[model samples]
Target: DTTVKQNPRYKLARVGKPVNLICSQTMNHDTMYWYQKKPNQAPKLLLFYYDKILNREADTFEKFQSSRPNNSFCSLYIGSAGLEYSAMYLCASSRDGPETLYFGSGTRLTVL
Candidate 1:
């Protein structure tokens, strides 16, 4: 596989509840990323895993959290869902830093 998978193509959460999204890739890529996209705005990088290393965007460090359980799987977790978090969650993979990313179709999250 090109190396990336996300579950629940779509999700709806109540405000203030926790939310978790899953992703996987088979390419054995060491670097995987998660981004949040909204209408009229650029996809914002949230966090990523470089092998066992984890990096979160400076501005988003506190807004989002992620973990890579293994080379083939990763997940993003939001402690408290909010309307502002309603957006498409994109999972991507790259061999290393600044490389082209292979993205999943994306998981659309809606907060109510």
Candidate 2:
């Protein structure tokens, strides 16, 4: 099976509560990624892990945070969900820097 799994295909949250999204990959890929994509916009890379190392995009460095509690699972945490945060959160896996990413259908977040 392809690696990567996410829960609650869709979610709705109030404007200020903390939001937690989950993802898992069974292939044991050393790398895992989390991206936020909005309608008609590019999938913005939020953060990724190479082994136990976490790397956040410079532009989004402060906007998002993530943790890989173990090799097979990872999470994207938004301390405070905002209206702007309403979008599709995608989880992907890649074996290395330049390769096709296997993605989940995504969890669409609606912040009201």
Model 2 global lDDT (CA atoms, 0 to 1): 0.90
Q: Give lDDT per model, in order.
A: 0.91, 0.90
Candidate 1, lDDT over the whole model: 0.91
Q: Write the per-residue lDDT of candidate 1 for residues 1-112, one digit (tens) a residue.
A: 6847899899999999999999999988888889999999999999988899999989888878888878899999999998999999999999875778999989999999
Determine which window of 10 residues in candidate 1 has minimal summed lDDT: 92-101
TM-score list, all predictions: 0.94, 0.94
